[model samples]
Target: MSGPSQEVVAPKAPQRIVILGATSAIAEAAARLWAANGARIILAGRNEARLNKIAADLKARGASEAIDWPLDFVTADAGAELGKMVDRLGGLDLLLLAYGISGDQGELERNPAAAAKVIATNFSSAAAWSLAAAAVLEKQRRGTLLVIGSVAGDRGRRSNFIYGATKGGLAHLVEGIAHKLAPLGARAVIIKPGFVETPMTAGMANNGPLWAKPDAIAPIIVRAGEKGGPVVYAPTFWRGIMLIVRNLPAAVFDRLNI
Candidate 1:
């Protein structure tokens, strides 16, 4: 029998973390930036060899332990497979779902199937996999879900409506998830970056005010996670700029053609 004077013991902290899109440039940078002193990691992605390499690299660079779980996002059961992997990892301190596919707007306009696939990967697939994370975080009542979004989602663009629409849906998804998850002690952070140079956008011009490389943007994400914030802009300066951008009249905004 328990008495009022008796004290209960708290569980130990979780050491394992899983990054669903392990091979991505920003995700790997995140792994490096947030390794802590000697954390354990479970890298999961489409390429088993790449995941293995990432795991080995993490272990070499201050991570106490690291392992790879092969996961293919193109497969039909990506969500279920990732959920099982997270469960097997025992407990996750952070779960990052950062899958993105660049869509060719010109081709997408001609082919409905192409646009549909891109949307599925960018929005539907991400949502499905994140549901897996949400379930685990809620059960644990203590974990973080970080999703990398883009400022392109803030407004539709003539050059890439297909891609912008996908990101728009993602923006909405992150907002909804953050509100629902906050009270449970589990939380989500939506990272809206303004033009980072990655393999994804090397061909694009880099003249924007806060344009930066993935390396520069990564530290911002790590800081946000450490500080426990729900939304973060990669350069931090974009917060004020976006506030003004969002408030401009649609007629003026359209004529300005940003």
Candidate 2:
């Protein structure tokens, strides 16, 4: 008698991914994970040299193909530029928006120019790229638009309310995008990470139980890109922490130094 019939499983297609602000620590870490899975990646950022270096490293780490494109997110015409990128890539699987700036809180408070720059980088530019990616995903009727948000957005704090406001605004924006994509079989996710030890937060006093490394946060990002809810908190505990922070009585909140 012959053996029982065997089943043949087809190989999965490699992911085509684009990472805006590809030089950021957390973004780079997430790209590494995707690369190991044989993803074809395009890195967009202002630093041509750094992007090239990261691309080479990704290729070395097992990416099917990795390339770099230098882009200045603040001044670019996001919709037009993103259309060009999508065309070049032939298709899209995920678009990760990871660029941001954290101006000194004291300087931002006193310097209108500095504050404006922060708002432009963190909110206005980020939103534009997000919407552009959402359009691409909608048209394809698949894929995910994953944006890097921060736990700082959960509530206004005396220390970094300006930055917090940008993130908070971004959270709401992504919520709407998520709703729009759901029926179309697409997805948009906002990743809210707590204190991550990246170059952006290098100057801050970071020793604490709450702080997390980019490598530790990267896996959550990779999973979310594949399949995720509208809003996710990396390290998971931040969700509870933010819940407590968001609901605290204003009278008591006002007295505490955050």
Candidate 3:
């Protein structure tokens, strides 16, 4: 038999999708995509108002159902609370974990608290949240756990090495979690987008052929989730770019300003 076509593999399903960082640009956009594709949405975040607003927007656009689940990723009990939220929601067909922080490395170098906060937001919270989701997903024995990774993690840039380090750690964490969860009939998809036009990146320059919008990034991610992509780069080209950068000769690579 001929293998399934890519189109056949990625058609949208009218299932329940929970967006953990529902207020963030990419997460909000992903929520909208799933909502538009006939999924019920559980918009989750620390701000009930923000999540409710997103739910209202999703309902206006024809989602089957929309609800808000207020969650604070920074809390000491965040992991356990997240596990409870999963049970309360009656299981999820898709889980989107997309919270992040843009760190000011200069200030972080001087302030230990600032440094820890960034690491917590970018790495600790993310891993914990994904782990919680994976626990339920594994028990169900069928579901997807998708989270945003960072291309910046592939290699360090002097401009934001601290941020890069945190993301690098996240990339490894999710990849390992994905492998562990695979046998449980659950899988993880890691998304790495080269600068996107979102509130977090509003003032940043578009890096040559690498820039993309949150709108552009969201659909690609949805498709990846539906089709079981392990690690996907938004806009596609970044895959080739990262491959080259990751394998560059260290002697010559260190000389080039990445």
The list of candidate 3 runs beyond 4 A from truth reads 1-14
lDDT of 1 by residue, 1-258 (tens): 965786666533336777878788888887876565576777878888888888878887888777787776656575567667776777778777766988667899999999989988888888877777777788888787788887778777677878888887887887788788888988788888887877788777887776787788767766655445677877888888788877888877777645
Which candidate's lDDT is highest? 2
lDDT scores in order? 0.77, 0.92, 0.81
Q: Candidate 2 on 1-258: residue-level lDDT in tens?
A: 999999977534338999999999999999999999999999999999999999999999999889899999999999999988888788899999998999888899999999999999999999999999999999999999999999999999999999999999999999999999999999999999999999999999999999999999999998888766799999899999999999999999999899
Instruction: Score every model by TM-score.
Output: 0.87, 0.94, 0.90
How high a TM-score does candidate 3 get?
0.90
lDDT of 1 at 27: 84
Give the CA lDDT, 0 to 100, for residue 55 in model 2.
96
Positional deviation of residue 175's Cα in model 2 after best superposition, in angstroms: 0.8
Return the TM-score for candidate 1, rounded to 2 decimals: 0.87
Q: After best superposition, candidate 2 residue 91: deviation in angstroms?
A: 0.8
lDDT of 1 at 139: 84
What's the lDDT of the predicted structure labeled candidate 3? 0.81
Best candidate per TM-score, number?
2
Question: Deviation in angstroms for 257 in model 3?
Answer: 3.3
